[model samples]
Target: MEEQRALRPPWALVRGAGDGSGWPWRSTLLLTVFVQVGSHFAAHGQEGGRAGLDAFARVLLVLACGQLLWRLRRPVPVVFGTAGVTALYLGAGYPYGPVFLAVAVACFSAVVAGHRRAAWAAVGLLWAVHLLVAHWLYRWLPPSGDSAASWGQEAVIAAWVAAIVALAELARVRREQWERERAERAEAARRRADEERLRIARELHDVLAHSISVIHVQAGVGLALLDSDPEQARTALTTIKSASKEALGEVRQVLDTLRTPGDAPRAPAPGLDRLPELVEQAASAGLTVHLEGEAPRLPPGADLAAFRIVQEALTNVVRHSGSRHARVRLDPGDRTSLRLCIDDDGPATGADAGGGGNGLAGMRERAAALGGTIEAGPRPDGGFRVLAVLPLRGEEEVDR
Candidate 1:
């Protein structure tokens, strides 16, 4: 289920209401009008000998209620100040009616802003003051003829305070849970982005590395036969042109996938079905590529990885092994695995073979990512060989 944030007052903004700029001036104005009405009611509620707040005391009451404008941003301080001023108004023997509303609101704001400890402390202090005032009214002031009525008023006040604290605490817990859920979602997105980047890098390497290697060899062949054998040189030139054009087209396709909308049609990913074209390209590069055994149907990921592995191995043969002849063997091992091996005769002039480049490392990573393995090195029989084995079962596990 999707987690939802706690509901808050219209004036409340930002977690803990710490952003001063989001304070609601209009809402404060409305609250001020309400408190003013409450103050007037308190003034008119004066009993027999009890007196209402004088001008200075009435001003203090208005100021106490106005302080709620900052309660969300500064809950603890607002609660303390409101409570202190309300206590003074009551202690001055002024008539009591709605003056305690300001203190109650401040305490609720503190709890909603995640200041539970301070809110509870304010509640305790306010309760103590209420007790003291009740005792004073009972002992010093003449009773209003009904002692039960006085007790009932005190009970009602206590109930209101408890309700405010309970509701505010519930809101605070929900807000905190929502924040944690949002953070987790963001982290998951970051991880998926990183994985996508790695996948694109691997695809680009596979597409360009083999194509560039073929073009390199054909270019060399064209240069050598340019003067001596014009016809052969022309053929080599054609091969280079075709190889480069195909590489450019494939690279553009890969890039276009990034910009394409989800519903747009896209070309299928390269797989073992394209191995024949790869072999023909290698042969045009002056490498005699002999193939044996057809590839069986495989999972899309495994098919692509297998094709890239063979392409990289042959490219290495043309560029590093210095061999004119190479052999590719495919073994469809049972229903769960496929094996591939590519080997080339030793260098034409007995030169030391160059070490594996990024092509080899990329091939290894592709194999490993598919729960497969690749081994490439000089064979004991004076040739370079690459062997790869890919598992077909559980492709979904590898893809994720």
Candidate 2:
């Protein structure tokens, strides 16, 4: 596949400063050619016998050579165009040593400007014509080791082609390297973006998921008593107030954990080590969420994991089951495993009983990230169950 290149913006003056083929090379090549040809002509007493232009040809040659400056902005076309003009000048018997040098340089520029194959093809065609030029020049030299004409005729072509070609190839490799670095940077940025998004999603789940579930439970209790009993309604109102304040505090804690301030100490994440309060609060809300377990003290991550499971299950009960009874069971396994299960007898079957879709998905993702698994489904008799088996040790221990 052809790799896409990011084109640099054109300079205010140079149309394609980094595009096509630009600057010094074009002018430098033409300059090398110009100096040689103009000086040689002047040495031969041509053009009024000075090292400069003729009244008419001087203006034209200077201008034509100056056009080499624009080759990068227009590479292939300038090359062909210069070659055509040089061919005409050669036909007119005007010496063009400098123009040939300029043409070779332009071909090199074409390669660096991202036309490597095209430039080589062009060199081939130009060399074919150059061979004809060579044949004509060779005819004048006698066959001898020291004959000046023999070497001079071919020396410039070989030297100039090799030097410029080497530089062009170097430029090609550098361009490829630059392209690779740019792609790696973009990929890194994409991965970081994905990571940040997942982090925000987890935080939202932790903070709002529990609090909303609590509010829902309290709201239901309040609504049930609003008409039937005023004293009971007042108690529900107090519960709502207390729940809201606590929720706000938990929200603050979660935000603090998620954020890094210019200055602030980071607290640890809440875990099931503090589950006594969570259980007591749920009981106050009227559901008897009896929890039983001899589970070992889990890792910090697993502690939070177990806590969230129970919290979510209790929330589901108050919101969907319409039942005031639920059970949470946690048991330690041999070595490095802990099994936790939360079940509720509620509405038994309803839209709300199916689990909070987004919340459940987030929980599963958290478990997966922690290298564990969870299973959730409706129980056979009634209600729903969430069974999660979290490995609490090193991969080696867990595997064993």
Best by lDDT: 1
Q: What's the TM-score of every candidate structure?
A: 0.76, 0.67
- Against the true structure, what is every candidate's RMSD? 5.1, 7.1
lDDT of 2 at 31: 79
Clashes of each: 0, 5
lDDT of 1 by residue, 150-214 (tens): 67777987898788788777767766776677688889889888767776777787777777777
Clashing residue pairs found in predicted model 2 = 21-72, 22-72, 33-98, 321-346, 321-347
Question: Per-residue lDDT of 305-347 in model 2, one digit per residue for the tens?
Answer: 6677667667666656667888888777775667778888655
Residue ranges of candidate 2 with Cα displaced over 4 Å: 1-73, 79-109, 137-170, 227-231, 250-266, 294-310, 331-334, 351-356, 393-400
- lDDT against the true structure, each candidate: 0.75, 0.63
